[model samples]
Target: MRRLAALVSLLLLPLLLPTPAQAAATPLQVYGAWHCGDDACIWGNVRSTTDFDAKNHWLIDRGDGRPSVNVVVLSFVHPVKLLHKTTDAQTLDGVPRGMTADIVNYFAGRGIRVMLSIGGITYTTAWNSALAENAAQFGRNAAEVAQRLGVGIEIDYEENSKPDLVGLQAFIDAYRSVLPYDPSGANPAARLTIDLAAGDRWLIDIGRKATADWLRTDTPVLDYANAMVPARQPSSSDAIANWQEHLDGKPTYSPPIPPLAPAKFTGAFYIAEGNKVRAECADFTASLQKSTGSFVQTAAPKGAGLTPGMLGYMFWAAERPSTKGVTTTPPNSCEGGVGGGATAYAIPIPMPALRQS
Candidate 1:
């Protein structure tokens, strides 16, 4: 009987190897650290006068042989004013006052694909006005900046209370029109993405409306939705479940929005403040590693709805907070530091490969 049982277990192992429902066939790429860490983030909090210190803010490759997150969201292009935009520009406050193009190229030269995030939490009104006033121009401007700087675009629209679906879609259409996606990777190495609320409870309306069109079928304009972090204390379960339900909508949806394929989503979270690292964030990492259980990675589509898994994780930041003290010295402060945050998520959570694309 023991011998027979052993034989049966061995036979079942092969059957368990493939997760058919997974979004991608390859093991899901770990897309960690959607950083805007510390003063270097420039877009979030304005800090010291030096641009050199901001560039080396994050210490990604520590020479410890641990797998660190490969990508960092260079962060923030707040308050879009493209109506009179120019290729050479500076931040409103002039904190990151220097040649923006050179700063962008510095990271790219080191093999890190930097994505320029447009719209922060405070710039909701600006986003509304920018998209509503001139979506095409806004798109062109975004594309121009992305092209010239050789970076990608991340629309961090946090208008959960009253999201402008029409205007948002218009922006997507306009941006994609100018910077269209090509399947063969022939297009310039530019990535486009957006942020949605953590779950359906808060942004339920969007989950229903967007599933039918914006996210489900428009792969050329956007990559996947980064379900922004700072939900309930332990929001991973709800976040993952919301994405799961997104793939298969709830019964109560009015007009019943189309289900979003898992291939079109990624979970995001914070690595600072009340969001506990060991207890809270690590569980989120485990769930993401599991591909939210019901989800999987795939590349069969290769078109409008290409590749799979929850597209990957986006951490709140990659820099140690100012409260953590200037972890690194001057000159290197731009891309250095991790004082109290040494064992933070960087090496624990799987990081994306140096995203050169």
Candidate 2:
């Protein structure tokens, strides 16, 4: 009789203890920014450390000793050029002259993770040509670049109307063949990821496919996805709405998109809008990063994994995102907004281990 009572207590104890998700919710693991290089999304020339530091002091030192972001994604390697292994005065061994080891070390030395983004909107056609020509080779080339640079890679293929999902898959498969996924995140090249549109509306086909396959918690093919900022900076409420769409996918579509795991993606916000320094770069209090932060940290899972809360925030385009936009230099720095966010969230200097599911 006593033995039976003890067994009953033991079973109840298991239920009494908090589940893994309930024990301690995952903190923001990726507080990142996309750097557009010196030439507005194109690294045109090799820059001396002195000159580079002068323009990017704000990123390295956010008015305090700590950096404003934990990760910096160097925006855009032309897919066609990378595929053809093109080399020119501005490019060396298929990589931009400016995306040299020095620039990577500049951020890495400060305990920040660096990644290289491939195929922006400008390279949409290039992506098609490369994928059609030889997606497997393109993937292999991208892997080579990642291995050489000691950085991660992001696939930003924005083919909205009609996407080449088959070719894209081939590319992903080839890349993974060279460098398999590393949940431990010890291997930088293993940290492969993709970019989705702001919401389920724009990149419908791609979003559906990614959510259904790649972004799954049980069998995650990619590290995560970055929901790129919309055409413009949205209000806090509007931003939440957009992010929520990802959490609860559009089930009514022709081929429904299953819900995405919270741990598998990050929501993006505009640091600056065109030439105007938005609140995300100028004032944390008025920023969407502030207003929608609670949702980002505690939003419940809708139809995917059991865990709550999304990964973290990603700011669009550091430095000059566009030819006419404000340069994130000196007086127009992001110290107040992006920097304040770091402090508020206590973002880990060296990004902590990300949640798998």
Candidate 3:
């Protein structure tokens, strides 16, 4: 009887242990900021388009194979205009200035998810009045951009000194209103997500309050929230600690902030850590998960090398190497160059479709 039980236990152990291939093929959303620049004229490989090309090329190599890294989100930046009412938007003709359909198509063909991120910390002022004064038009413009790009949308609204939750929600609501239920021509489930500042406790408070009502009513307001981890170690710890504390304690309003319950929700709580540039990402993810047990993805500027347990990454700067800081570029490279040669791994599950009930 003991021998028979041991044989049965051995059979179950293999089934329980997750293999690297299985882990690398889940829904990991890795993103990189891409740019259109004049650098292709020199160093051939160092050209501005190299990073963008290399990204897609990387996918071709990994397609249906044992893709250690899957699901790429390419952020197109540069002379690209996010605003609809601006003179450039009005004057520019033929698919809006700087938006190349060919480039967008290049990514989509590879089964990668490309998102147009509007209003980073640098250009956040664009929303100051747009959100406060006129939210309706903001939505219209955002939808139009999504339509033109044929990709999903993202709002990276990161303002620390003057974080306004009301204004932020207003902008998100406005954008949600205009977007069609199925914006992706190919994937109807694709929708918009907001990258909230992790450092701001006030912002988190407002988001939870808003999400409670939004979730109950089933408004297409917010699909997922990306919590931005600070650049330094202490900052990352503080961000996670405060968020966990808020979720775990206190009852200021109805429907208290939701704790990191793996059973109830699978929302993402991510942080950006230096790749090979710094060895803290693996440890950072481990500590945060220990605290909340939420899904985590390590955010790295474009070239940071891979870390263990990384769901995906968000690289800084659309333009790098040739284009320079026109966009915030990631420093460390797995491929060992500015052209993005670093190879990372993650599970490649198709992005869950957002259902509008």
Candidate 4:
């Protein structure tokens, strides 16, 4: 029986090989971190002191006609937080202000669609309280915010404490209610996305379940799920190994057709320890190609993982490279105590057709 099983697996290998078209198929989404508006504005955070004007931020490069990078997912739009500071709550119900709208227009003018990440690590605290108490309201609030921003929302709920799948479902249900079904159609307003952590244990539990739910087209929670800062596995081969491991597991829920086709390979900080990052990037790309039969951008090596598949790629704050921490000493007493230069290098691959928005 074991030999027969091996024989069956061998026979299926040819059929499993991705065709050239599949190998070259562009990812569903890709690009840089979109940080605009007051919250994400360089002036708003401790990490940055450099104020990013709309024209000068890291959305794209200035030189040459061709974009050094492609596809930009704009990070942010508060969930349940109303826009405009005032006692009046209704005005606050959507995006904080027209800044999100303005940013979207700027990117859209250049044919780029920004994904509005609803919650970050900090923002999850609010969700922790809101979700269990008011799931439906949470969704409604998200939809309103996305509507006002004129962008899709990426739910970046990285709170390990709040691994409540039920809460996540509620948020998704609420957001989906407000978004248009056809993202590519005319005036197709707002998209729903989620940013998942890629920690080994975390991915096995929270990441896998959340992604499985989103991948299920039938599940009304999310249209997209962005795996954030994917950590490297035990070895280079672990890239594909990790993905297969997730696929093999049983999720609490899922769609008939899984959301991911080529899968995602998003990691941040491409310039750590000099040339080390580049080597890791090479291994990451090779592994995905070998295991999944997909081509990925040659990410510079300081980080873990590769950029493969339709769900393009993303980094953390867009301003990190141009700000205070660009070349600063390590705050904590950890190995490699201090660092210099940009923590990440730019991956200038173009991703024009990845996302509908």
lDDT of each: 0.53, 0.88, 0.41, 0.44
Which one wins on lDDT? 2
* CA displacement after TM-score superposition, residue 339 of candidate 2 (Å): 0.7
Runs with alpha carbons beyond 4 Å of true place in candidate 3? 1-51, 54-81, 84-99, 161-170, 180-190, 199-206, 214-220, 233-332, 335-346, 349-357
lDDT (10s digit) by residue, model 2, range 235-313: 8888888888999999998888888888888999988677678889889888888888888888778889777778899
lDDT of 1 by residue, 1-357 (tens): 999999999999988797666342444443545555455444434334355434443434433523234445665565454434633344533123332555555555545556767777767787887777777777777777777667777788777677777877777777788777543333433467677666555566666656556565543346556766654434446555655555555657565645555566666644443423432223433433333433434323323343444455555655443344332333322121222122333333323331121
lDDT of 2 at 268: 95
Rate residue 207 of model 2 by lDDT.
96
Between prediction 1 and prediction 3, the one with superior lDDT is 1
Preferred candidate (TM-score higher): 1 or 4: 1
Return the TM-score for candidate 4, rounded to 2 decimals. 0.60
* Model 1 residue 179 CA deviation in Å: 1.2
Give the true-structure RMSD of model 4.
10.2
- Lowest summed lDDT over 10 consecutive residues: which window, candidate 1? 333-342
Model 4 CA lDDT for position 288: 27
Compute the lDDT of residue 316 as modeled in candidate 1.
62
After superposition, which runs of candidate 1 have C-alpha atoms over 4 Å from their true positions? Answer: 1-26, 40-59, 62-67, 86-99, 185-189, 217-220, 232-236, 275-308, 320-357
Best by TM-score: 2
